[model samples]
Target: MKTLYRYISLELVKTATTAFFLFLFVILINRASQIAETILGQGVSFLDFFSILLKMLPAFFGIVIPIALIISITMVFLSMESNNEITALKSCGVSIKQISVPVIILGVVASAISFYSTMYLAPKSNVEVKRDIERLVKKKLTMSITPKNFSSNFPGIIFYVEKIFPQKGIIEDFMVSIQKKDKLITIFGKEGNLRTENDTVFLDILNGSAQILNWKKPKDFQFLTFKNYTVELFKFSSEERFNARKYQTLSQLLKEKNVESQTEILKRLCLSLSPLIVGILIFSIAVSLPRGAFGTGISLTLLTIVIYYVLYTFSKRLAFGLKLPEIALLPDILFGALSGLLYYLSIKEKLKIHTGARW
Candidate 1:
């Protein structure tokens, strides 16, 4: 029994590890072009691009580990059933419960990994990735801004320059338009210098003129001239930038009291436990199905993944839309109940088979 358990566990671990990396690689390849455009297009170095990719793994792990576990369990058990190995084990008095032990153990481990990734590592990585990208953007800002092209990278402001000397951090014929709630503010300068102080980027315009036009009264317009004027392009402060839920850690999320935070907490917990729920469900289905059900098993696995994620996404949207955090638990509850029912039926079938053989 020990040897059998070890053999099964080893096979499961090997297959699952392989599948996990393979799936991750395929997903990275699928997103390669988009990632390249985002990073390389920004003129970020290759090292920085690779670093961002590495930081992104935790987010992928939270999603990919459970998927790999389910696929591995289905493939292993279905292969065993197809080759009559399950029947041979059963004939030797090895019960379905015994066969399930390895799967349960693997599920627990995978669930732990998923929990860590989602609750801790993923959030931390998200913040780091954001910070890194922000840093790269700030570093490459001069290079990214094209002369004679109006750039809207800064929120609520559009700026154009007739000429730019990136090395000298100087601009000629700098023009900026800013939209306000009640009016439009436009600034023009013959020369300007770009500089950064801490987290803020500032443009100091020389010999500039400002024009303000009121939206409510088209005839009401104000114009002013100045020797020097400064415009704050943007800021990257942590308090304002990192306030999103995705950038928050588990402890940080726990301290917040709001509908979104509560929903996020529930969603993370449910996602963490999904692997065990899905593993048991697939295991029961694998054991109960007929020998020649390999195609059915694969189909079922794919369908289960699709259904689970769809339900999860819908529940999250419903929860946020209705401001009810409990709605987020719907997917896990439904899947948990279905898993229990299928497990019961599989055990009953095994018991009946044993009794008939004895008779």
Candidate 2:
């Protein structure tokens, strides 16, 4: 019995690990493709993009690991059944319930990990990643403004320059335009440059000329030139405060502050419970597999995974839309009960006892 239990546990672990890496590779590839485009356009190194993706992995794992575990367990059990090992065990009087003990233990561990990622690691990474991106954008904005290409920093305002000595802080053949209600203004300069002071950005033009065209006056072409002219930099919006859902951890969700928040919290908690339910469901399906060909067992395993995912998704939607309090447990309970029913049915079949049994 010990050997058999060890064998089963080992097989499940192998299957789970294989599934995790396979799916994780696929995820990384997809993310890499998107990152490639972003880096190429922004002239950023691949290393920087990879760093951002690495930081995002906790959230990704929170979703992928659960699905991988479910499918892997199903596949492992079905494979064992197809090989007749389960039949041999049964003949030796080792019950299906006994075989399921290790899977249940694994299920509990996975659930705890899921809860930690969703509540803690995920939110922390999200906040930090946002700050990182914001900093990158500001840096890029400062470094990118140069002469030769037309820049539309502020809409309805255009900047053009023929030559720029960035190190010396000077520009030549510079032009600036501003358009407003019934008026168009244009400025030209022999030199211009950028200035930053006290958290304010300014564009200073030297020896520049401005022209205004007013629609109301048919002959109005007002023009002005100055030794030095400055325009305020376009301001970036400040980061907003963290909302209840965005940064709240699982522990906070369990506290359930208000009516709406309570529902959300319950929904999140229920998602954490799904792994246990799925593990039990896998056991029930595994025990039901008859001594069969590989195709038969694998097909049934796939079907069980599909059914479980459908039920989980449906319950999650109901939790979110219907204001179902503590509704997260609903899917877990439903699947767990189904597992119990299947186990009981398996026992009935093994005993070969019906309504009228011969003593």
Candidate 3:
């Protein structure tokens, strides 16, 4: 039994590693362009780009591991069955449940990994990524202000520049508009630049004109002109407060008593347990040598993943968006019970794991 367990466990690990890298590679390729565009005109070096990639990895791992586990287990178990390995084990007095012991252990290990990534690493990396990108924007404020496009880089304000020099942090034909609670304030400037002093960002506009319009009264309007105008963009120091639902750690979430905190806590926790739940659920679909495409197990794995993702997304939406936080664990519990039942049914029927007819 130890030898058999070792063999099965090793195979699962090997296949899971391969699948994880393949998924990671594809995701990296998909996102590479966005990262390039981020630092394209920001005076960034190749080494800086690599640093940004490493900083973004934790968040990616949190999302990718559970997905790869489903694919890996399905491929490994299906391959073993196709090669008559499961049949050989059965002839040696191994029950289906006994043969599942190694997979169950693997599930537990993967669950630990998922918990670590989601609970601490992912959130930390997310915060770092935000800070890093924000730093890039600050380094060259003009980089974010593209000509012919409106930029809402400042809170509650949007601006457009007819021309911009990102390297020199200069803009020409600048116009910014802001809505201040029942009034619209518009500013037009001949030129603009950024000023940084004591880690504070300020937009310095030259020869700018301003107009204030009252929505309630068409004639109640004001106009002004200035040789120089200064607007605070942001302040980045130890005193600066950064707070968001996804940017918080587990401890911070526990300390808060609000809908956002509740939703995030439940969501993160349930995601942490998803690996074990999804792993066992997917493992139950494996049986003897497949009969046609229906029993191949890989397609069943994909189907299970899709179904779980649907339920997972629905649960998240209900909990986070709809104020129904109690249902966050519904998918995990429901799918776990379903997996257990299917395993029992498979053992009784013997080699008939595909239950599409019943569903």
Candidate 4:
């Protein structure tokens, strides 16, 4: 019994490790591709790109590890069932519950790791990534602004770029709009060039026009056309709202006590427990069905993972939109209860099989 238990434990762990790496690899590639377009286009140093990648890693693991665990355990057990190892073990007096504890323990460990990542590492990493981005935007102005979209990343200002030329190092159709507390400024240019001094970004525009308006007096507006224009693109400020709720630690979040912080806390809790809950659901299905039939387990596993993530996304939207943190736990609670019911029925089926064979 000891040997059998050890073998099962090792197999599950080994399989889970493989699944974890595979899924992590896929996620890394996908995530890299998504951000690469925006960040890499700037022609930044490779070290900066690598730093960004590392900072973003912990933020995703909390969500992906659970799916990896679900897939790993389900795949291994279903393979065993397909090969009749489970049937043989049963014939030799091994109970499903007895053999399954190892996988469940592994799932628990995965759950704990997920919880830690979501509650601690994720928030820290998010803050680090935000800081990294803020620093980068300040350090490299031309590379930081992605052309063709409105970006509010700059402190207290929003701007849009129409076209960017890396080879010629020119910006075409340059337009900037800035609104300060008491003043509003708008500038338009046919073309512009960027200059960096120490850590500041300066935009040098030729054949441009500027309009100034006093916000307090709407009727006071002045427009001027110029042959050459110069302006500071972005200045780094510690007062920027980079301390977002998502990037705050648990203590910080609790102290905020706002709907946003409450939403994040519940979302983390739901995400942390999702693995164990989904694992149970997968186990309940894998145990009762014949594994080799149409790869139903794989299909269901994928479906469950998709549905699980969708639930979180929707829950997050609802929680923030409706100002309700309780809604975040809806999916977790519903799936957990369903998993229990399925597991109960599966155990009953196994018992019936055992009894019928004796008769």
Candidate 5:
């Protein structure tokens, strides 16, 4: 029994590992174009791009591990059943429940990994990825201001530069228009230098004059002149301001009291348990198949995965729309009940035969 268990567990582990990497590679290839456009087009360094991809792995693992487990379970059990190995075991008094021990253990292990990635690593990496992208955007914007054309990349501000000295970060004949709620503020500078500090872009204009006109009263205009005037061109969010539900850790989500947070918490927990829930369900389905049902088993595996994800997504949307966090557990509850029913039927079918013969 020990040898049998070790053999089964090792086979499962090897197959799942291969499937996990294969699925992950396929996903990365599918998204290669989008990733290149986002990272390379922004002129980000290769090292930084690689770092971002590494940071994204936890989220990918959370998605692909469960899939790999399901595929591995289906493949292994189907092969065994096709070869009449399950029948041979049953003839020797090995019950279906006893044969399922290895699968149940593997399910628990996979669930633990999924839990860690979804609850902690994925959220932390999400935050880091957002910060990295924001930093890269700021870097690109600072160097991308084109001369001889009107630039409106920054919100509420437009820049028109007659000439730019890229090496010195200086602009000549700089004109900027600032739109306000009830007024228009324009500045004209003979020369301006650009600098970035923290999350803000500062343009220090030399020998500049400002003209302000109230929108409601065009006749009420104000004018001022200065040797040096600083205009904040762009500002990115700081760490304190970078708060989103997807970017929060499990602990952070638990501390918050709100509909979105509660919904997110339940969603994460349900997703984490999905592997075990779906694993048992798939295992029961696999064991109940007749001999030489290899193609059917594979088809059922794919269909089950699709159905589970569709139901999960629908339940999550329904939960959020209805503001009922408990709805997030619907998929797990339904699948779990199905697993129990299938297991019972499989065992009862074996009992009815009473001769340990292949069905």
Candidate 6:
């Protein structure tokens, strides 16, 4: 029994580790690709981009590891059963429950890790990711504003850029429009430039024309050919509301004491539960097959994982849109439960075949 336990435990660990790495690799590649365009186009440093990517992996790994563990456990048992190792154990009087305790222990440990990661680390990292993006935008915005393009529309002002260069701090073909007390003022310049000293940014224009339109008065226009024009600029702060998925902490989701928040909480919980459920499903399907079906086991495991993730995605949208109860995650929970139950049934079927045989 000791030998059997050791062998089974070792095999489970090995299979789990392999599956984890495989999942991690696929996730990292997909994630890195999605962000690559922004990093290169916005002139974010390679080191900064890489740092953000590295921080992102913990969240990815947290989600992936659970599913990997489930599939690995299934594969290990399947391999053993196909090779008559499970039969040998049963012949020696080992019960199914005896074999299940270790898997349950593994599940408990995985669940704890998932809770810790999603509850604290992921939220903190998500905030950091946002901050990094803001920094990248701020750094690039000054450079991105160029000649003949509408940069951004502020409350009462519109800015147009002509050309910009980093080393020279030069801007050309500049225009600014401001509305003051119902008076519309338009400024056009031959050349313009930007400079930042401390927290203040200055838009400097040279040799520009100014036109003012007042509601109650005749149009007043002034054309000035000057050495320089300087305007003290204030940056736009981001005040966008965060969705539950974007930057929410797990505790906030869990303890919110509201129906919508509770629904979101359940959805996140589903994300956490996914690995175990998916793993069990994969394992049961894998083990029921004969030895020659190793390739099939791998293929099925991948297919099932993809399908589950798709279900997870669609379910979250539905849950949020419908303001579903916390129990809305029941469908996913059922799917997972069915996998385990089916695995049990498959075991019974195999046992029945053995007992009825007259070979």
Candidate 4 on 158-233: residue-level lDDT in tens? 6678898754457888678878779889889899887667656678899989899998997989999998878886
Number of the top-ranking candidate, with TM-score as the measure? 3
Off by over 4 Å in 1: 142-151, 159-175, 180-183, 187-194, 204-211, 214-230, 238-241, 350-359
The top-ranked prediction according to lDDT is 1
Candidate 3 has an lDDT of 0.78
Q: lDDT of each model, Cα atoms only? A: 0.84, 0.68, 0.78, 0.78, 0.82, 0.67
lDDT of 5 at 281: 80
RMSD of each: 4.6, 7.3, 3.4, 3.9, 5.2, 5.2
Predicted candidate 6 versus true structure: per-residue lDDT over 199-270, tens digit per residue: 456677788877777766664544455676687655545464456554678766766677677776676677
Where does model 5 exceed 4 Å of error? 142-195, 203-230, 237-239, 350-359
Candidate 4 residue spans exceeding 4 A from truth: 144-173, 190-201, 215-220, 225-229, 239-241, 350-359
Candidate 5, 45-75: lDDT as tens digits: 7788778777777777788999999899999
Indicate the TM-score of model 6: 0.74
Candidate 6 pairs with clashing backbones: 67-275, 70-279, 71-279, 74-283, 78-287, 146-161, 147-161, 147-162, 147-163, 148-161
Give TM-scores for every candidate, taking all chains together and pairing residue i with residue i.
0.84, 0.70, 0.88, 0.85, 0.80, 0.74
By TM-score, rank the candidates, best first.
Answer: 3, 4, 1, 5, 6, 2
Question: What does the lDDT read for residue 19 in candidate 2?
Answer: 84
Q: What is the lDDT of residue 123 in candidate 2?
A: 80
Q: Which ten residues in a row have the lowest lDDT in candidate 1?
A: 350-359
Model 2 lDDT-worst window of ten: 350-359
Candidate 6 runs further than 4 Å off: 40-44, 95-97, 140-202, 206-227, 231-245, 350-359
Report the lDDT tens digits of candidate 1 across residue range 1-359: 99999988988888899999999988777666667765564446789888888888787888899999999999998888878888899899998888999988998999999999988999998988878777876776665566788878677888798987766578899788888788889999999887788878888889999999999998989999999889777776657467888888789888988889999988888888888999999989887767777788888899999999999999989998999999998988999999888877776665222212112
